[model samples]
Target chain A: MVWLLVLIPLLLAVAAVLIPSGRLRPWLVPFGGLIQVVLVVFAISSENVSGFQGWLLLDPLGKLVLLFISVLFFICSLYVPGYLSLRAERPTRLFCACLLSMLGMMTLMTLSHHLGLMWVAMEATTLASAPLLLFNSSTRSLEATWKYLLIGSVGIALALLGSFFLAYASLYEGLESTLQFDDLIKLAPHLSKPWLHAAFVLLLVGYGTKMGLAPMHTWKPDAYGEAPGLVGALLAGGVTSCAFLAILRFYSLCVASGEAAFAREIFIFSGILSMVVAAVFMIRQRDFKRMLAYSSVEHMGILVLGIGVGGLATYGALLHLLTNGLTKGVLFLSAGNIHRAFGSKLTDDVRGAIRRVPMSGALFLAGFLAITGSPPFGPFISEFTILNGAIGSGKFVVAALFLLLLAIVFVGMGSTVLRVTQGTPSTPATATDFRESPRFVIPILLFLGMSLLLGLYIPPQLESLLKNAALFVENGV
Target chain B: MYQLIDPILVAVLLLNFAALGASQLRTVIHAIALQGVLLGVLVVVAHNEFTIWAVLMACAAITLKGIFIPRLLFHAIREVSIRREVEPIIGFIASLLLGGLGTALAVLFSNTLPIAQEHVGSLIVPAALSTTLTGFLILTTRVKAITQVVGYLVLENGIFIFGMLLVEAMPFLVEIGVLLDLFVAIFVMGIIINRISREFSTVSTRNLSSLKE
Candidate 1:
């Protein structure tokens, strides 16, 4: 079942490349995404924990990340066909192939137990997603693609170096050096502290680059702004989660070595710094897609901050992962629809999205509410829980600062969203032709509904999963 | 004789200095190739029995890094007709000085770590780190895209040397995967650079300032 989860997407990627018809190729995404989800269910239900030797295994954390990526991919896949149709030209087979290949690589990143294999998978994702970001082939997209490639490659290379440091750390413990996560955890306490510290820093920077954590997230805006919306959704939601999971694995090692406090400090600094940076940039952001990018930065900050706060915050952080992923899915898809509707992403050109494409505009508005942590929505609930966790842990100053940043982000994002969604149609040409298709709006609605449902009620099974995953982070099991 | 390779690592450090001082693309490429050759020698001399497979791989790396990539870059540069990486964001002298300071820092910092192995030489880690820093300096300071790629190659070489310290930890397949990924990434960047030159008529990243906030 585990092999099937990994192999199915790889097969689809190959098929996407081999198939000549552009129209027929995109269907491979949804088909593969569904199959992956089904396989995840089967894997979770089975009693076996160990599988695939040194290469792949479905531990609790991996299972959680896999479940998140699978569901997120499935939601974003539903939005792809409609999003592709909006392109004036026929979709290239390359786009479909790269997207599926990225899907495969992200799945592999989630499932791989070996740190080396995980790095390879992460690098493969950078290669796979670069072309997708180049879908428009505009000069700006080219620039974005270059920045994404250079920054992502450098980050992953650092990660590889970090992996080596980690392996070397094992030597100090009298253990045969290996890249397997379990082996490393068993040897964690005995490993040299200096090398472990260096390893954690490198790993944080490397994976944090992928996660679009601040200071390392210069590429997120350009890449997310220019990529097709479905691609943005997958990247912001699926790929970033996988990278966070990688960081969480290393954090687990730090905890095992009794360096949890050190790890927590770094996480807190980076996380809060990300949030503050995101808030600052989001205030003046002009492009809608760019706004979404800053939101990604802010959410990544919250995710890490949740873990950094530890205790109940870990569970809240895990819950925020689900909410953030779903909310991004809704926003990116709806933003795609609105961008298509207005024939522009510039704040100056787009107006009265509600009057034009009512379904997309309304969902975009709802997505905005949810993303900014407005009440009665999923993000609000998750964000509140994280804040409560912070307060409960006697982090009064941190909690205060977090709330301040969140409020600033909410205002910055809300104003921009309102400006785009509420006004009368400013562009006469776009308004006359604007209409919401069910294909686009339905996916947005589904994602929004799922996010809202999670807010209203946490399913007992998922709560258990989140708690178990948190335990894995708190203890090194 | 095996200890003779220790001094050659100093050549790798000097090559980075030459790269930092280089204003012309041609000189920079040559310097990078020299570093690559020095690394190939280090790899061969550092290993105990010099198996045929290891020798062949080193030869291939040397040929690719030393010859083919530089040649391809030169061809791209000539075709684009850009003469020099003129007016770097940081001046040449400052970059070289920074490169020297970076080397000093690397040496100072690396000595603090408890490294178990002695045969690998104390200089390998620092040389690799300084080269990596110099590569980053060139990458950030220079405007020309080809020079930036050369800088990236130097950085990769630095990382490669660092990885050598843990050669035991790296499986053969994983090492190959890393190399293959680097090759493909550079190839893709090369294609993009060609496109940038064709579209914008210059390989400088300054022309890419159009997308900013």
Candidate 2:
């Protein structure tokens, strides 16, 4: 069953590369996404299938990220068919192949129980996304691809070093060296303290770079700004979640080692720094897409800050990962529609999105409100929970700062989103031969609806999943 | 017993300085390629006995890190036809000085970390730290994209040094040289380095600043 998760996508990716029809190729994305989603649903709901031992297993954290990637990909897959059709001038053979391959690796990443295997899968994810970033073939996209690849690889390489350090930490303590998470956790108490601390620092810096954490988030703006919206949605929502999952694995190891406090300090520091960095850069941002890139940095900060705060905050952080992933899909996909309509991602050139592509534009606006913790949106619920967790744990200063950063980001993001959505439908935008097609708009609507539904009520099953995942991290077995 | 490992580790350290100090791109690549080959030798030398895993690792390190990666880099430079000189953001000599200072600090820092009794006096920890720091220095200070790749290679090589200490745990790391080879190909976008050159007409990352705040 675990092998099926990786095999289906790999086979479909091969099929995508082999298929010649430009018209028929992109359907492979949704095909692979649907298959994986079915597998995940069955895997989670049935609970009868035994997972592959050691190399692959879906724990609560893995299950949560797997669900996020599958849903996000399925939504983006639906968007891709429409997206590729509009740009029918170019071939999408490589794009489809790489996208499918990325799904395969992301699935492998989620299911990988071995640290070395996870590192390989994560590196593969970085490789798979490079072509997607460069899909436009413009020089600017080339620059974006260059930065994204170089910076991302460096981070992964650092992560590789960290993984080696972690393995060595166990060996140095006179234990048999194994990269399996189960063995590491079982032996965590006997691991060398200094090496464990060192490993945590390097892993945080390494994976945090990929997660777009501030001070290490130099690649986010360029990559996110230039990629097509569907690609950005996957990169932002899907790839970053995998990195967050990687961090959670290490953090759980820290918990097993009884160094939870040490790990939390680093998380809290980096989290606040990311939010502060995002807030500073976000004000008066000219490029709307680039502004969204900063917004991603801000949310990543919130996710880590929640984890760092612990107790209820850990649960809040876990829930926010899903909410943030869904909301970002709404924002990026809708924003993509607007970008397509105007053929511009700059705020000066594009406006009146609401009047132009009413469905995507309204979703984008609602997405902004929801992302900023506005009531009735899912992010509001998650962010409020994070707030309760922070203050509940007597982190008054962190709580206050978290709210202040959220307000600043809201004001900053609101201005850009409103600037893009408020004015009369512009001449060039309407002239781009783009329209509010149901195919393009439905996915955004589904994502937005999900977020709204989550805010109104938390589903009991998902609540259990979030609780289990949080417990897995805070109190590793 | 430690006689063979000490000289090899020293040679690796010398190559680090050579990479840091080289002005020409060809020389820098040569230094890095040599470092890659030395790292392969270091893998075998660091191990107490020759086994299939050690041999496989040495071969992988030589093939991927020592040969294949450098070949791809050379192809990138040749295809791009950029100037052979490495244009440093900070002067090469100053960077070399900084590299020395980092090496010194690394030795100092390694002493602070507790080590197993068997490996207490070995240079593996300090040398790895220094090489990684030097790699980072090259990446930040160099202006060209290819040099950045070189910097990354050095960084990986440094990390490779640590794996020598935990061979039992990191068996796949012996095969990691192949993964390292893939890093250059994928990061350089297989053949898109040529396209990047044609688009921008230069391989300097300085020009990539057009999209910035």
Of the candidates shown, which would achieve the greatest TM-score relative to the real structure? 2
Evaluate model 1: give its lDDT: 0.82
Model 1, runs deviating above 4 Å: A88-91, A429-434, B117-121, B169-177, B180-190
* Residues B70-133, model 1: lDDT tens digits: 7777777777777665557888889888998998998887787678755334576787677778
Query: Model 2, residue A41: what's the lDDT?
Result: 86
Model 1 lDDT per residue over A47-112, tens place? 665556857888888878888888888878887776676663844677777878888899889889
Per-residue lDDT over A1-477 for candidate 2, one digit per residue giving the tens place of the 0 to 100 score: 678888889899999989988878989899889988998888877564336566788888888889888988988899889989887776588888899999999999998988888888898898888888888888898889888888887888788888877877887888986788989999998999888998999998889989999898999999999999999899999999999999999999999999999999989999999999999999988788898899999999999999999999999998899898899988899889988888888888888988888888888999899888898988999999999999999999999999999999989888888999998966755388888889999999999999998899988988898899999989875
Best-matching candidate per lDDT: 2
Q: What DockQ does each prediction reach against the true complex?
A: 0.50, 0.68
What TM-score did chain B of candidate 1 earn? 0.89
Error of 1 at A179 (Å): 1.0
True A-B contacts kept by model 1: 0.33
TM-score of each: 0.96, 0.98
